[model samples]
Target: MHILVVDDESVIREGLARILEGDSFTVDAAKNGHAAIELLQQKQFDLIITDLKMPGMSGFEVLNAVKILQPDTPVIMITGFATVETAVEAMKNGTVDYIVKPFTPEQILEKVHLALEQKKSTVEDIVVKKEIDCHHGFDEFVGESREMQKVYRRIIQVAATDSTVLITGESGTGKEVAARAIHKHSSRRDQPFVAVDCTALAENLLESELFGHVKGSFTGAMQTKMGLLMVADGGTLFLDEVSNISLSTQAKLLRVLQERQVTPIGGTQPVSFNIHLVAATNRSLKAMVAEGKFREDLFFRLNIIPLELPPLRERKGDIPLLIRHFMNKFVEEVGKDVRGISPDAMHFLENYSYPGNVRELVNTIERAVVLCEGDVIQKENLELGEAAEVCSTGFDGFVPTNAEALKEMKRHIRDRSVENVEKAFVIQALKRNNWNISRAAEETGMLRPNFQTMLKRLGISVKDYFGR
Candidate 1:
């Protein structure tokens, strides 16, 4: 946690810093509200302690600035003459707590914890209200099934808290989308949402990309760089395929999460970070932990708020809704005349078990929409990549009551079957040209920055790619 102490009195300013530092918080002292505002612009702090009556800028001014500058940040007010009206005024001005000048050490610490806890609650209330306020799911994600309703309810319940979320599901199950929705509905919605694919990058560069490094930390070190932890300060960091992170990097990450401080490589000082973590993985982290591949401690730390996504096969009732959603999307996207799926094609789709889940189904719909001659997508237009077994009951698998699953399944064959195919494609392009990034970017018709961003998201470091 990072805290800013602002007071015209030197004793009060420095004393608070010392007190917070002892509590394991990174503290910065500002002589007045003006200096506090300046520091606020340069860095992110979890809490701000400002005296109500400052020489240059009053605490009221600082409170207003904080509300504008970092609205989510909590501010505590301090004054010598504490009165009920003054306290109400301070609270009205957005001070989480009001304290008198002669406050004891216990009072300060108690108020600090209480205020921070309230801040967490405030964030949850704001986010949860925003999500449930609509009383509906996002337009992009369509599911009216009971299972999906449960998922939606879970998102609503958990989106409000700063708890580290561990989203587990198979590939193509929209894990990242769920993460994004959680962020969108949270207090940090306006902040940057950085997504990193753990499987895309090599082991060595992952830390530097995440925790950052100082210049000359290693050979070919060019300039000092800010890590994603700093960049994501006061916001959420989504780690995709987190199971792929190496054990060594996992140890470093565990320290950061535990301490809330990140020391750049070759740098002596540890930078304070206030970031929410939301990690997703297709692989079983528990199994990996049992096998001694994943760190048990790190696994336990990340499993604070577990959210498991149900596969499409298990949510067969939602197939029709999903198909229609995609149908409308692709209809406008491809500018095709295709209106909807034929009865036979819909039956074929409903019967098939989508191994790859929603992603494969969408890919199939996109292809079918393009190939369809008329308004309706015919069964053959589906190209029914694979056939599903039929039960005598009909569309259902085997049970007559649940027999809706038994119809002849039309397999959804998508070209990008591999989850990391895009990452691999970029890697292949880089390798084909001997890792000449600029050349690869030009050949691939992507800007250099875009290519580099893709690499960063995939965690692909050119230096690491060449066995650096």
Candidate 2:
């Protein structure tokens, strides 16, 4: 870690710098707080060790300035008159730690280590919290896609309202996850988020599961049981694959949505419940209604505000993010010290269609992380099974050097014949993918609309390339 040492005393500064250097830390020294601030402006440091009694700018002033400038970096204060009140005031002024003067080198280093550790922990916490806030509850929802942005905005807008929501998307598009997010972000976040796969259980069990049942209601009913709806009262009920629910069950559910009550099996009294209903289906509900497989009125009841999660192919830009997220999760689960994925591995990940959507991508990364032995995950570590050759993106097994990076940047800037940067990026992606638009789009993590724009800008004709 980079450490900045600030003190007016040359002897103290030189002594501390020697100790820190011995500990293998990169050190920057300044005789006063003003010099320290100037050095900080030019470069980033992980921790700042400043003497509280500096002449030009006092340690308190420096701490306040750093708090405003780079709050993530921590500052530790050194004081000769180490009073409880002074230490507390220094802490309140944003000093991560306060050390007494005449401290051993070990004591100072220990405090610096603690400060850096806290800073790292704080950064990780912020990242996870931001993800949870963005996704509501599930971290599976990954996107910077314009369509996904609209979906996120809609979710936030409708979360506070107790409207019945219908989530529609392809099978692997994370509809159930979206349902949970709505519930988590809603007023009833503390209550249960009950999910029932409408197609998994038999009709009789499904009805009993949702509406509850009294003792001796059915052949196997030995005890009174609360159904999913009542359990989810004050929260949300997610009905997955809602189109598959039997017509009879649909009618019963529609009544619950309409009247906010559930009648236990073979019971006369209808128990009142307050719940937000969220239903999801891969099939087109409108088509199902026309085909008499789904109830039109029930569809109307659930379709008050719809949220459709885009397919993986539509938001391929999130693959890198999803890969990193899954890698971190797997590292925690498996207790591994793997550093990162190889460039070729990332290329392969970016190109695949991921027909199973984000779930498929996550599973793929998790599997790679678990099977890999080395510090970095490589292309050979992944067992894609049938997905191996589906990538359109190129893999050159290149690890970038500073000279290569500079050359690539200069080449990129000069390539006006290839179109603007976005288009050129797509063309470079196509070159990587062997000129396959579909694969190039996947590799570049561009959705079809954005990919199409990329190709048009690059003077590429899909018809000419694919003979479509």
Candidate 3:
């Protein structure tokens, strides 16, 4: 550890440096606060020992400078004139401890060790708290794969700005979770976070819900209601499954995005709003725009910052981490004694494809925790259903007249079966990802070029799957 000694007297400064250096600490001596401040700006110190009364700048000034520059470093005040009030003042100014002048070597050493230990404890506490916050604050997104790391980086990058974000992913792939994470990390974190499910309400009701309504705007509009846009003023408004919004509502949403103003159904004046918009969708807004089903202008406005979340299948390496997270969560919630999953059960879970993504994994673990009778969760505790079944049906009742014919027939059957399975696998991945070739390739854990090569070999046209 490195320490800085600031004392106007040469003998005192040199003595403190020698004592600390003898104890295996690198020491730097400064005649006054200005020199100490200069040294602080140039290098980092683990601790600062400054005399309370100095020539030009006092120890209080040094303490204040240390607080501004390196608040984590502990400061110890030493002085010839020591009193209860001075000690109290030093403590209040953020000094770790104070020592009187003409002190013994043992006294100085004991105070330095105690201050360093306290600083270590404080730092460790902060680190542990940050780790806990990262898990719970980010909604328990337990993954460290390259794909997840990319998503994390993107979320952080966009969260610093007010740019509109469009999150695209399959259902249950945590689009809303990503939106919440963005909001949590943004400047408006302390403000409200209003989430609206666009698929939940009808066109008129959704409009009223978003744009608010004056009293008597419609048959059931008995009272004036504040819209989510107004509710999320100075905060964030998350629109979940924005692709389900009607074309007319889409036009109004575009206006809101463009003008930052909202007009109620029966009100005349427009209510201005300052809100961060984050929209999520499982469907393709680009395709919808091409088909005229969605407004192209609105799509462009919402697509300023696009974040595509990779499916769970694409980052299978993170499955074990996610499983452990879910297991801990469900075990606590269900009040079960389930401590772990059997090796066989864990292997099955890791290999089984999760079509519904993380949400499905969460459900599976919850169910297993509830059904597990012993301390460990076995394969029988999991209810994967049809997803767990492996195809093993063999040709039956087929007899050939000769050995050569039988051999040829078997070869043809094997080749046909392999081709069918491969085609089905590719098609399923494509279907799951809305026919996006890149996404399909990622979901199947294949490189884009390799996936495209397979598509060509299989004679599969991506355009054919569009709008399906």
Candidate 4:
């Protein structure tokens, strides 16, 4: 651990530094807040201990600067005279710990340890941050693969801006999830996030759905209804499958986006809406523009921040995370005790190209969970697609295609470990049995302790399985 110690008293600084160093911690000393800030800018420290009152710059100034510059780093406040008001103010300024004069070495070390642990836990939780539990979060969108990480980074960068975003991807590559992610991370997150599927309704209905219509605007328009755009004012309006909207509706949408006002059909005046527009489509808007099916100007308007989500095949490294997620989801959905997928089943999943991307994989896991009977989900339960031919063997020497070689390599890696697959199965089984270890073990043909061992091996505990 790296620590920064700031104190005007040379003895106090040296004492703390020596104690922390004895605990195998790298320590940096600063005579005051200015020196601390200089050191901070030069190097990253896990923890910072500073005197409350300092020369040049007060500790409060340092705390505020750290909050902006390095919010993740924990700060501990130390002072010779401790007051309730000062301590409260220190905490409010984001001090992780407070130390009084004449403190023991163990006391300082203990606070440092606790502060580091808290920071770590907080960071870890942010890694798995969720938007609203529809499973869209920074963590839920899985992929360490460069392509997916690039998408994530781009989303983070663009979410802070108010520019309209047009997301284009193949069907089921999580366009909606990406849209939700952008909305969740944006400044408009506090307001309603309304989604409208352009293809789900007719042209006339879509027009009214976007812009509120009068009571007698058309047939069956019995009541004056507020459209999605008006309802989502000051928030986000997600138009999914946006390319499916007719040219007439596209023109109307373009007008609203360009003018920042929605005029209801049969209404004389336009209703102004302060909204962020995020449109997504499985169809290529550029191609549609070239085909003259979609307006070119509208395409350019919505494409201010273009984000494309790669298909599952391109980010197959995320398959395991997605599989684990779906397994947890299915166990809750089906109320089953099935442990997880078998080795062969996992190989099939890893090698098979998911044309429907994450959506198809989710469905496959759900189905497998429902069909699985034993403690462990076997190959028979998977009901998965055909494994892409990994190795094409002719009579003698065969030249392997690139696609085949890649598939073979993935299959070999997946086949090397059934341990992960088994844990997923066990989690499913525990969920099915309502997290009863004995029942889960009985259902999976493993002993109680052995099942616990598996849980430990999988980095899961019974309390977690049972939601304790």
Candidate 5:
């Protein structure tokens, strides 16, 4: 584990570093609190030892900063002029322990060991509780529908073994949550669970991130760095939006999977890792492979065990359960006194189809909870968006007697479906091009004027997606 030592005195800082280093701990020492805070921002430390009295930015100030930055990390305060009042004040300010200066190395080591052990126990307890909750029919999921039950079963079946899992679903269908569930139930639950978003980084940066690079490997490579695969060694690595990975990276990933080893960008030495791989994507790898966008070999490797999540529309019976779950969650989080949803609000929520799936429902509920004034949430409190407003009009009791009327009804349904699909396509194109209309049009093989016309017809505002 990594530990940081902060002291204005060089002698105290060096002495603490020697003691911690001798105990097999990676240590970084800072002469003052300002330098210590800078290191904290750059790297993560499991424990921090700071002297109470400093020239500026005292240990108490450092503790406050850490509470805002890394709240979970334990801090130990050391002072030469230690008193009962000072010790009590340190404990009140969130320091795990207080140590008097001129202390023996044994005392410091014992305190460090105790603090780390306590932190480990607290983390493991939380993990164990979550695992237990999930074991009882997947607590993360709210539905009791057969579709979700099947998903739970598949997760349990594949989690026991170290098999590559590919989760396919639409956006906001809780793909990452499923990946976490798999990792939590697996034997490597105690190890690190690293998650990476493939779509967030450029191709070159992503390649460097996945495979470590030695010093002077590339233009910006100033020092050797360990890749995420090595960081997740003996644990799980979740790759979200894996389909966005470029073909060249796919080939390299396939080799890593086939050989169970990774070679750094400039280093010839190969480092081996044992990680349970879980990949998720909203897009279809099969179609991408057929279109020559994704490698078929890598697809097969990742698809050893496949799990598909059902969209909210497909399992509408679970909407009420989900609404209540989200309502209780947001009410507590927002510290609102909302006790229930009105009948009209619940009806609108249950009937409205969430194109964005569970994530949309979550946002809707949180908004209502914040806007709600009374004990119960009203229909006005729920903002279902423009799409929901358009789709809310359904022919509930309309019985068409003539063939013409029935044909008109069918035509209306078809038009609405087409409109939804067209809007989704246009939005996706704009997103891929970072809201650049000209580039989006060119990529989609459409004239700029035609793309703008379509955007206007679909009521899509470029400004809405620009900065956001």
Candidate 6:
């Protein structure tokens, strides 16, 4: 840990530095707040301990400067003239802890440890400073893949401005989740987050929903209605599935983006708006534009910040980590005693192709957590795809011509279908007999030898059903 100790008194600053450095912490001492600010501008520190009463810049001023320099860095305020109001003010200014001078070394070290614990690094190795202020949002996402890292960096870049963001990804890839992250990290997080699914409403009603209508504007317009744009004023407006929006509505949306004004249906005056627009889509807006389905002008406006979430299949290495996260979450949410999953089950889940991506994986884990009877989830507890449907885990060196691939595809489908049926039959039989192979074979009217043979062929073993 790197610590910066700032004090007008040379003895206190040097003594604190010696104590921290004695414990193997990297220490730097600043004579005053101005010198401390100069050091902060030069480099980063994990924690800052500043005297409340300094020669030039007070500790409160130092705290504010530190916030602008490194918002993640924790600050500890110390002084001999500590009062109740000063302590309260210290905490209100983002100081991790306040301490009166003439204290023991243990108290200083303890506060320093706690302050350093709160520093969450957004990037490793390289230190970065930016003017945009944002906090909290990326914790929900659980992955360290290169693509996800890039996504995090992109969100940080666009969150500072009011630029329109367009998130493109497949179903269940967490497009809305990404949008929420951007909003939470943006300056408009404290305000409302209004999400409008462009495909959720009829063409006529969509405009009314986006722009407020005066009393008796349409047949069903019983009273004045405040549109989502007005509701999201001084906040963020997320438009989901923008590719499915009607062209007429798209044109009105374009005007809203350009003019920052909305004219409700059957209304006279245009209502001005100040909102950050974030749009998401599962379909390719670019492709729709080429085909003359989506408006080209609106596409450019919404595409100012484009973020694409990768499918689970492409990032298979992250499956195990995601599974563990879901398992821990479901364990707490469902009040289950499950602590872990069997290696066989974990391996099976890791290898299975997730066609529905992260959303599908979450549902799969939720089901498994609900069905799990023991402390560890087994392979039998999981049913990844529909009816155990199988797909290629990867193209392992086998390449077929387009004309010749149909037969192979059919063969795979038929083989998987048959295997699914057989697996289901054996699983039902075992479940009925409490997973006893001999009795399960008897109940199924099959010889024990044949039953055990099928079990071995299907990679099913007694250890999977019961404790090994």
Name the top lDDT candidate.
5
Q: Please provide, for model 4 over 1-468, each residue's C-alpha lDDT reduced to its tens digit, 9 standing for 90 to 100.
A: 899999888998999989999999999999988888898899998999988887788888889988877889999988666464696678976997798877999998899999999999998887666333223325457655567778888888888888889998988888888888988989999999999998899989888888989989899999999999999999999999998889888887888888898888888898889988999998878878988999999999999999999977655556765777788888988898866666557645654556567888888788888888776666677664333232111111233457877687556446434544765688788879987989999998999999888765544545432431
Model 4, position 423: C-alpha lDDT score? 54
Estimate, for each residue in 1-468, the C-alpha lDDT of model 1 and write its tens digit: 888988999988878877788888889999987788899899988898888877878888999999989989999888886464676698987888888878788889999999899988988998996565333346346676566777776776677899999999988988999898888878998998999989888886888889888999987669998999899999899999999999899999999999999998878999998888999999889989988999999999999999998878666657766777788888999999876666557655755666668898899898898898998888888764433333211222323222332332322123112313665578778878888999999999999999988876544556433532
| Root-mean-square deviation of Cα positions for candidate 3 versus the true structure, in angstroms | 13.4
As a TM-score, model 4 comes out at: 0.60
Top candidate when judged by TM-score against the true structure: 6
Instruction: Report the lDDT of model 6 for residue 94.
Output: 93
Report every candidate's CA lDDT. 0.80, 0.78, 0.84, 0.79, 0.85, 0.81
Model 6 residue 159 lDDT score:
87
Task: Name the runs in model 6 displaced over 4 angstroms.
Answer: 1-137, 384-388, 392-468
Report the C-alpha lDDT of model 5 over 15-93, residue by residue, as the tens digit. 9999999999999999998999899899999999998889989999999989978999999999776464786688887
Model 4: lDDT equals: 0.79
True lDDT of residue 300, candidate 6: 95
- Of 3 and 5, the candidate ahead on lDDT is 5
Q: Compute each candidate's TM-score over C-alphas.
A: 0.57, 0.57, 0.60, 0.60, 0.57, 0.61
Candidate 6 local lDDT, residue 140: 69
Question: Mind giving the per-residue lDDT tens digits that candidate 3 earns over 1-468?
Answer: 999999999999889888888899999999999999999999999999998888889889999999999989999998665464686688987998999878888898999999999999999998997676454434547776678778888998999999999999988889988999999999999999999999999999999999999999899999999999999999999999999999999998888779999999999999899999999999889989988999999999999999999877566667767877889888998898877777557656755556678898899899999999999888888887653543111232346777886997678557646755776788778879988999999989999999999876654556433432
Ranking of candidates on lDDT, top first: 5, 3, 6, 1, 4, 2
After superposition, the stretches of candidate 1 with alpha carbons farther than 4 Å from their true spots are 1-136, 387-468
lDDT score for candidate 3 against the true structure: 0.84
Considering TM-score, which of the candidate structures 1 and 3 is the better prediction for this target?
3
